[model samples]
Target: MSAKTKNKHDQSESPRLGASAFSARSKRVTVNMGDGQKVKTLTPKQRGATTEQKSVAKDVKKVMAKCKEEHDMRLDLSRCEVTELPRYIKELSHLEEMYLYGNRLTTLPPEISSLLNLKILALSENMLSSLPDEAESLLCLKVLDLRHNRLKEVPFVVYQLRSLQTLFLRFNRVTSLTPEIKNLTQLTTLSMRENKFKELPEEIGYLRCLSVLDVAHNHLEHLPHSIGNCNQLVTLDVQHNELVDLPETIGCLTCLKRLGIRYNRIREIPAELEKCSDLEEFNIEQNKLKTLPEGLLKRFKNCSSLQLARNQFEEFPSGPPAQFGPLTSFSIEHNKVTIVPFGVFSEAKKLTKVHLKDNLISSLPLDFGSWVQITELNLASNQISKLPDDIKHLTKLEVLILSNNVIKLLPKSIGGLCNLIHLDLEGNRLESLPAEIGYLTSLTKLSVQSNRLTVLPRGIGHLVNLKHFSAGENNLTQLPEEMGTLESLEELYLNDNPNLQMLPFELALCRKLALMSIEGCPLGRLPPQVVDGGPSAIIMYLRTQGPYRAMSFS
Candidate 1:
């Protein structure tokens, strides 16, 4: 056979040969050519195989070269499912930023320390059991986020990151912080909320540059006195903790603008807090404070708004410095206050709003009218029986709430309050309204529900701007025919009046009237004109037997 045919036959038989059989017969062959400088050429089959193998090898080399360049480049692989870092990651000497959030990474390779240029490292939402010792070597790291992890304790080496400015470890199981945490002098913000911290480290004061410290929703029973040493702190939220009392050193936070201590067991405030002159907002709500020291008011004289509701004070204190005139809004609702101090408001001339609801006030001082600048007053659920005549002096009063009181009558001088916009006297024993009430031309809302009123004054029609009038559950037997003059009236509640027999036909003239409720009245039907009037009127008529029921004005 020819050489080519012989080579093909050998290739076909090679597959049938056993591994040992083929190796036993394999041998190196040397051939000599006619020229003295001999040259041996491969057979046709061997040359084709060698050429193909070389081409594949070259392609693989090109691909491997590209992968090396990528492995050495900086990468931001945040929020991925990478279980472990590539071994070549150690070659990335230029890597500056790395984010590995929301992964199942259990441990980091010590080679991470090779990244000296890294500035931000986020490894949050991972199953990391502990940090590598080389973590401290990241000198250029500025921010570190490891929140929502099972970290029971922070590594001591973390304190060596002098360049760290912000650190977050929220929703972790950390029980204590190392005193070395204070070594992070460059840190400006630290969040460790929802932890098992029993108390703060005394060295915490060493973080003089910290502006925000959130240790809320923890097991902290007391704060370190050094906490007040953080002079630059502006916001401190320690709410939902077991703190029974605050340290007097808290007053040292002169730069604090907002302080929240709600949902704690705190019973009293530290008198040193009076020194927080720069404080603009302070919330101690939902505490066990029985009374506030008068000095606190003098200290926070610049405060414009204060919330002291849900406390144990039987009476509000009077010693808030006379210079605390800047106070414009005050709330003492839901307290044990039995009476408002006689002249408690005399010096509060700048006071614009006062809330005294849910108290035991039986009477108000005759001088209560001295709050001339007051615009809103809430005296609901009190025992007040009468208002002083001087109430007319409140010309600027726009809202007056006296609901659930025993008031028998309103001062006829109420008409002098031209600025009164809303008057609520619901749940009272009022028998009648003074005719002068009609002088409230600016009145837009009037509520007299659950009263003993028999009739409204004839001048009620003079309030052309009245948009809402509710007299439900009263002894009203009839409404004044002139009530139709309220061109702007939109809602009129007259239900539960068993004696009311008829409504005036003039109601048809109220072109803007929208809702009219006479459901429980003795009237059987509405006037024909009112029923045939514009679609804007929605009358809820009752079914009753009476001569007025058949009367029609059409």
Candidate 2:
């Protein structure tokens, strides 16, 4: 009747899938990952020089001469301490681009305007508090980057750049922009993040070509209604502001796709957002909204991901509207959701992840297990009591976390989860697990700590892939010696099993064992030296009982 002896006997009679068959099924659950695509930035040009290019900071004269020799060339003097531009730079007026970023220059010399061929000018990260009026003479300039400077206001002369397409003014002291900023009709990207702009000029709406606008971390309390005039705007970021409400006109941006307004004082989502049909990702976490406006979810039907964490929601909305069918990921953690409507997730076929952790839900819907496509299901730290038997429908599940709950038993069908890799049942009232647990051959981490279990199924030995096992603070009088079959085991914890009487000699055979805890167990079989010794010594002493005698660490 010994567990290990019984396990070996069962292995002969039991019907199990062969490696070749299991490999085919595993492929059905596992997806072939593709190479990640490189992010495409909206910067006008790539910064930094090629590895073979020498630094041209020490001698602008020689570098400028090279630019003159070539009708069109680039001159980079960025990251150098050059305080002034030599008047000779005016001779290389044909230079197509100029870079003077990260320097000690306080002003742009009037002579810099002589570069009529300059198209890209990067003068960021300097001590510039003012720009020279002559800078306006470069009519061919298309990109202007003056970010990370001490300028309290954008130089009025910059408004004269009728050909500029991109402008950056982030991390500056610019508090006001002249009305003439609207004259940059060709601008496509404008950044003013981390600035002192208390208010944006209405003229910003005149940039019809503007597609991206970032103004996060500012003191603005309101946006002008005219901002809605940017009909081509695609991405808008205005997080960490004092705005109590968004201009109703914001819904005018029919092309907007992504909008982030987290950490704001907004109390409600504007009804006008119904016009934003293309809005894909909407982040409005950490706001003061208590009740979601009705029909709001029906507005952004195309949003793939939505986050409403850390809000004052007492109960989740009742039904899963058809509009939410396309969602891939959803989160409502750290809320007061007492009940999650069964219909809320019934339609989410493509939903890959759902996080409702740290909620007040006491029980799941009887059909909760119907969600089979989910790869990661985190319902930890809830008041759930029992899992429904149908949970086996999630055959593709990889991570199942039910820790810190009142779950008393796992469904016998849990073994059907052939792809499960991690299972956590800690801090539960479970008295026992289904022997079917042995069927989870893919399991790598299993934790049943702080439970009321008196014993584990002998079939646990079937988990040949297990690497870590935690079973502390249980009522077990004996551990199944079959656990020694975990050849891949690395860390094991069996502390606080007060009634345990002996050690499993077979455990010493686990060569991959590195950490083991067996404290609080009264075992007279082990010598005082072996008992006082740590995992290595205990393992070494046990191995001596066999034919292999070896020294080990404390």
Best by TM-score: 2
Model 2 spans with C-alpha error above 4 angstroms: 1-60, 78-85, 100-107, 124-129, 149-153, 173-180, 318-320, 472-479, 493-505, 514-554
lDDT (Cα, 0-100) at 277 in candidate 1: 78
Off by over 4 Å in 1: 1-161, 168-180, 192-199, 216-219, 320-323, 462-468, 485-492, 501-522, 525-554
Tens-digit per-residue lDDT, 1-554, candidate 2: 36586345323322221221000000112223456755443321143332212233335556566667865467776655556777778887878777776666788778988988888888777888988889888899888887778989888998998898878787788887889998899988787877888888888889989998888888888888988999899988898877788898998999999998888888877878768888898778777766666666657778888787777778874344565677888888777889987667777778887888889889888777788898888898989998888888999899999999999989899999999999999999999988999999999999999999999999899999999999988988877888778989999999998887777877876778899888887766678777878667778877787444453313
lDDT of each: 0.76, 0.79
Q: Taking the tens digit of each residue's C-alpha lDDT, what string does model 1 give over 1-554?
A: 36586346333322121121001111233457768966775552454435433443343344334534766333544434445665455666676666666556777888888878888777777877678888887999887877767888876768889998888777688999889988899988888877798888999999999898888889888999999889999889898899999999998999887787877889988788878876776667677888776667766656777777777768885574363466788888778788776677777778888888888989987678788989989999888999989999999999999999999989998998999999999999999999998999999999999999989898999999999999989999888878878989999988888887677655655656778776677664556554454223323232122333353423
The true-versus-predicted C-alpha distance at residue 51 of model 2, in Å, is: 24
Please give the lDDT score at residue 5 for candidate 2.
60
